[model samples]
Target chain A: MFEVRIHSRGGQGGVTAARLLALAAVRDGKYATAFPFYGAERRGAPVVSFVRIDDAPIRISSQIKKPDLVIVLDPSVMDVVDVLQGLKPGGRVLLNARERRDMKGYPTFTVDLTGIALREKLEVAGSPILNTPVLGALAKMGIVTMESAKSAITEMFSDPRNVSAAEAAYRELVA
Target chain B: MLTVATGNKAVAAAVKEAAPAVVAAYPITPQTEIVEQIAEYVSSGELKSQYIPVESEHSAMAACIGASVTGARTFTATSSHGLHYMHEMVNWAAGARLPIVMANVNRALGPGWNIWAEHTDAFQERDSGWLQVYVGSVQEAFDAVLMAFCIAEDERVLLPVMVNLDGFLLSHTMQPLEIEKAGDFIPPLHLPHAIDPQNPCGYGTLTGPDDYFRLRWDIERSMRDAVDVIRGTQERFARRFGRKYGMVDEYRCDDAEVVIVAAGTLGREAEVAVDLLRDEGTRAGSMRIRWFRPFPRLDLSGRDVVVIDRDYSFGFGGVLAKSIAATEGARPFSVIAGLGGQEVTYEDIAGFVRNRQPGRELWFGVNGDV
Candidate 1:
């Protein structure tokens, strides 16, 4: 079993990322669960979400604190918060940032999600959101299968053109 | 067959199916959708109900209470401060035993005023004499609504049932919700039968001090009886839809030396948290209290316990911890955390494992208040 936690502020696509990941896991014929921790019960506040995927039915009912993979939606969150509080020592960090060298220490990967959203002409930047971009980088880092992530994104978007653009951006981001 | 839906919609659809004659609710944030969907049903004539568009959350509850005593299947929805406004009738409906069903989208009660998911509002009404059942998903909300009607109308248990779900956590989320068609129950176990004025019976009648205590005690017995009725309803629901959500369901707590008991969304959150720890060799688990009124003693009969209360019982302490301490468990500790919508971070729960001691029930985080 593997757990993933996403650190994002209100309306930043943390919930969508977790759901997309879980749905992909489910599509992979593995058991999966995705849910968000409703924080401050408001927008623009730091919020966390949990996702679990396992070979067996996932039965434990709490949040994922010690996670194998932690994704941060906003780099500003790192300064105001210690997003790495409970990451497993050898775990991977995926950040939605433009630069990767500055995010030293642990194994880190970067993707400019805003840049991808802009390039793909995605709906309101907050809608198709950064989650899709981070998920693409998740594929590049070998955290989850790219094929699975691409397939998941294809299933998520309603328009064929956007789906094609997201897949293309995903490829461009990885390259 | 059960369909996936947000918990908010499930409860609303359940109320609609049961044929509640009078439906009233003001548009509060999270809970507003339940009544909004129900209003759609009424306007489309999909549900033969009187959709009363009220002006305030307080009146929504009051209208339900009053209509219920008139022997109408009554319903309403509210969250946080709106729930606070309806606090007075929370007891009024229960004392009157009006058998109304309300869906409280669990929101953090406020001084700072935030509208997110927490068990604060429902927890504040712990002793309100109303039956409270918290659901993990929208589907459970559907099951609870039907069970609430059956339990509340029972001759033994005539109390209102507040079927609660985490507001934004489950409310705004979309899912494929299965609603019972008009004749799905076969015999139509629909609500809102005649008030039987032919016999001129009295309802919401006055009770003097001499009879109040006995009446209250009897109400206690009725609540306990509801635990069994709730169990029976779960069984029936299973036969009808192959899903069983028991009152005191335990997961991985069997060989556990410690079990944290919680309700509503946190229980589900704890579910994900426990899975991660179990894989890492942590001997921790959780118990979800589906039925809050009866308190489900047998559920805690012999387990090392910690109570994760999302709300604080001012003047007292964490109700979950108190209930565990009062139940005489294996000297379990109570971890009071997540008060007033404060995030009970999953890490905060894991922290409970290494730091719990026996003597006093422990609170996870103490910020000014419990």
Candidate 2:
């Protein structure tokens, strides 16, 4: 089973990102489940969501303590939350940053999802939609096929910018 | 079509397929998504139903009963406080023998104010003459809702049905769901005693003391007869949709010496615990009680049982644990856990099996065994 933990602020669509990833995995002919860690969430409060993908139907519903991959949608949340706290030994980290950062020993992947969302003009109210663009980085990391990722995005969203933002992130991701 | 969706959306999807004539609901946390999705379907012309955004949950159920008596297929959804607020109408719907299907997102009753998964809310309605079915997955949620309409409307069992899904745990969780087109699986409702509003017939007439007990006994008689109806509906659903279900879902229990019994998602998680215990040479199994009201007869005579209850009765014992003891005569190790959505992992479930103490109660997360 491949478990993923996503960290982002409450209003940044972190939960939707988990759902999209799980949906993409399902489209790839695998079983998946996604859920959010409900807390006293507000606009800027740090929040977490989880996704589990496996060949068989996923049964475990508890929060993923040790995730195989950790994706940080907001690099600023890294200051308050330990994005690497319960990461497995061989786990990988994907960050929404313009440049790569040292993660001691873990393999880190960088993708400027915020820049891609803005470049594609994928803003909701006034914030760049990081959730859709992050799926492109996940696809680039071979977590899911680019085809399934785009399909999942279009299945839930109608705007063309969401797909463009994901495609841009898929090309710019430094894995 | 096979797709990924939350348990809430899955229920809404099934309701859409059933195409009820009326959907009257008031939204609440964890349960709001279900009514929202159904409302959207109605507004989008995908589902032709009278969607009533009721003022309160009481009015929600009341409107359903009002429409149901006039032979209209009705549906509604609610949660913890919303469910309690509609308590009177809940019993009225069942006592009146209205086949109104409801999806209740099970949540903890608040004193400190919490909105997470717990079975206490549904347990409170155990004897309301409603056939209760607790589901573990998004797919089961959809299937249960569809089958609920069939089971409730059967001539032999005209009782209401409540499909309970754990709040947040199942309601908010998204999983792969194969949406079945319930075309003709649920036949047209032919309510035997439906009142025609145009004729102006009096309904809910006062029951005199002489015949009150008989009326109550009739409810029980129909409740007992519902078992067969439920079985037939499930069997037909399986043959048509290719997915089968039963009153109890057993995992690895064929040759096991120890069994863990639970309901809802805890029941699904127990399967993983069974696998973990098997590696250590312990023959542990899991029996998930899907049907709560008109409870299925359990077969755990020789096995040592470990029962996990996500609900408590306060001053008594765990509702599930005590029910098993009363019916099966097995003194199970009652482990009270997951109240207000405290995380209960499969590892913890395996430990409960490892440390089996019959005839004892353990309040998990609190100190010792009582």
Candidate 3:
């Protein structure tokens, strides 16, 4: 089972991102699970969400320490937290920024999600979160399918507003 | 008899056929319709069982465990947060080896709060030693509930089974399902329930550290062995209902040089991609897993494997790929994609097939800007 660890501030959609990831897997007919570990479980606190994706049933049950893939949704998390602590030697890191990883440790890519989210109109009260836009980049980058990501978002939001916003974010990211 | 049915309705049919003596549940998102249908049966007197409509999900599973211990086949259903609220009871039921069966209309858990389908509910409960199964189409969800009962109640494997349903996909989505007649479903799997005066015994014993490990080991062993039962039970269900469910569903993979792995609803989408790829002469294949608990590794070997994981493992990527990697002596190329409910596309999948590695992981579709 492949575990994905996401780092974001509380309310930055880390947990939402995790669930969306699982829902996307569901859309693709893959056995997937997502959860998060937060100290305060409130807004603004640093947050981390975990996802286990597999073609088979998952058995290991522990907070993932070493991640095969680490996604830093919020750039500030890179400053305050150790995002690279437990990365596998050759693991790839996806960051939400315009600048690629200049730090020495691992392979990284920087996609300007705020720019995509703004174009896609996927903002909550003027705050353009990077989740869906990043998803779009992942799709273009040849990871999972865009349909599965869309399905996951559809599965996530009951509000058409949220769904449409996610779609816009996707379009903007791709655009 | 065989008739077109929705996924939730299929689960209800399976529960009815299992004929649990006492079924307790509270209506919650996606999972509500299940109890609604079963309640109809109870009211119509078509089924003989105590249908307890409790106030909450915790009470629902609580009633189920109490009934099971008292020698009644017990069942219930819930969604995301509801499952989280009653998460403790899930472990209690399985730890007690109560053999309870429930359907989770897989929903997203809340902080900002959402009522959509996702595996977070069951995913949070994976280590509880409860047998977990993910169904892709409504047909699989329909039959998984029946197969779950047969497997759960097997004296050799008396653990709770959570037949996870995609919230709206199966929970709210409509589909055609074939159900076996009552007689055909029951009889072979009637379980012995607890009765006050008839039989006296312990319900759930508090395990001390000494015997706890061994008891848990036994449970794990049963869980391991339950893999075969999962396949066997599905086979028997197919014999009766004319469908099939195995640990893994391999599509267009017989002659495939490159393979993509996933489970649940994504399997259908991946199937679409695989078909499109075949038409385009890519020779790509897909493997969707039905059983999430006993991860079937028999089919995963050295072939190029691209694991698409929706959930995130903090330190590593691709929980499924890692599980597969642990089994294989040689690792294939794997990519980590689809996180936080991101949409996965066919073109994205085609790209993976195009850049195919036998055993490597690629993490894509992410934003580095916040």
Candidate 4:
């Protein structure tokens, strides 16, 4: 099983990112489950969601303690939360950043998801939509096929810009 | 359609397919999504049902009972405090032999005010004559709701059924689901005692002691009959939808010396624990009890039992552990865990089995008390 934990603020669509990733995994013919760790969260409060993908039917319902991958949708949340608290030894990290930062030793991938969303004009309210674009980064990292990821995004969202933003992130990601 | 959905959404989808005539519900946290989705379906003209947004859970159930007695298929959903608030109407729906189907998102009842996953809310309703089935996954939640209507409306068992899913844990969890057309699987409800305006019969009035005693007996008799009804409905459902369900979901129990017994999501997680113990050569198995009201006959006479109960009976003990002891006549190591959505992982479950002490109870995270 491949387990992932996503860190972001409450209203930043971290939960939806987890759902879209799981849906893409399902579309790729694997079993997947996604859920948010709901707390007394309001907008901008650091929140997390989990996703699990496996070859067989996923039976366990407990929260992931040691994730194989950790995704940071908002770099600001790293100040309040330890995104890599229970990451497995030599686990990978995916961050939504304009430029890469030095990590201890883990292989890190970076994507300017916010910049891509803004470029594609996928802003909701005032925040650039990071969740949809982040899927492209995940797909580029081989977490899912680009076709499956784009299909998953289109299945949930009718807006064509969400798909375009993902395509932009896929091309601009720095692995 | 193959898609990913939350447990609440799956229940709403099944309810929509069942095409209930009336859906009277009051929104409660965790369970609110189900009513919200159903109301959207009603508004979008996808589901043709009278959606009643009531003031309280009591009114929600009362409205369902009123509509159900009029031979209209009725549905409702509620959670912890909301379920307790409708305690009167819940029993009334069952006692009146109304085939009302309800989806209960099991949540913790509170003085501390929690909205997390727990089974005590539905556990307390065990004797209300409502057939209860706790689902472990989003797909099971969908399938159980579809089956609940058929089993409840069966002429042999004209009683309400409550399909339960753990709040937040299962209710909010998104999983791959295959939605099927429930075409003719749930035969149109034929309520024999439906209120007829032409005949104009009186019901629910004061009854004499003798008839009241018989009425109570009738509920019990039908309760016994429900076991067969549940089995037949499940069998037919499997034939139609290609998914089968049993009274208890067993995993690696065939050649095990010790078995962990549980219900709801905890029960599903136990399977992983069983696999871990087996890797260490401990011969562990899991039996997830699905039906709670007409409790199934478990075959645990020769195995050492480790029963995990998410709900406690306060002064008595863990309800599930006591139930296993009473029915199977075997002493079990009772573990009380996961109350108010305390995280009980597969590793913790495996540890419980490794430190098993028979005829004893251990409360996880509450040190020093056995």
lDDT of 1 by residue, B1-370 (tens): 3333456777788887788889988888778878888999999988999889888877888888767766787778888888889889888888777788888888876666778777868878888899888887666778778777777776667788888887766675433345665245422223343355457765666778879998798778888888877787778777886777787767788777667778876776676666656877877778888887767764555556667777767767677777767775545666666555556655567666556665455655553322
Cα lDDT, model 2, residue B124: 94
* lDDT at position B303, candidate 3: 65
Which candidate has the top score in lDDT? 2
lDDT of 3 by residue, B34-77 (tens): 99999999999877889998988888889898888765677898
> How would the candidate models be sorted by lDDT, starting from the highest?
2, 4, 1, 3
- Name the lDDT value of residue B251 in candidate 1: 73
Regions of model 3 farther than 4 Å from truth? A1-175, B1-4, B188-204, B329-342, B345-347, B355-365, B368-370
Q: Spell out the clash pairs found in candidate 2.
A: none
- For candidate 4, the per-residue lDDT at B51 reads 99
Q: lDDT for every model? A: 0.72, 0.95, 0.71, 0.94
RMSD from true fold, candidate 3: 14.0
Interface RMSD of 4: 0.5
Ranking by DockQ: 4, 2, 1, 3
Error of 3 at B251 (Å): 1.1
Which structure among the candidates has the greatest DockQ? Answer: 4
Query: Per-residue lDDT of B240-357 in model 4, one digit per residue for the tens?
Result: 9899899999999999899999999999999999999999999999999999988988888789999999998988999999998998898999999999999999999999999999
- Give DockQ: model 1: 0.20
DockQ for each candidate?
0.20, 0.90, 0.02, 0.92
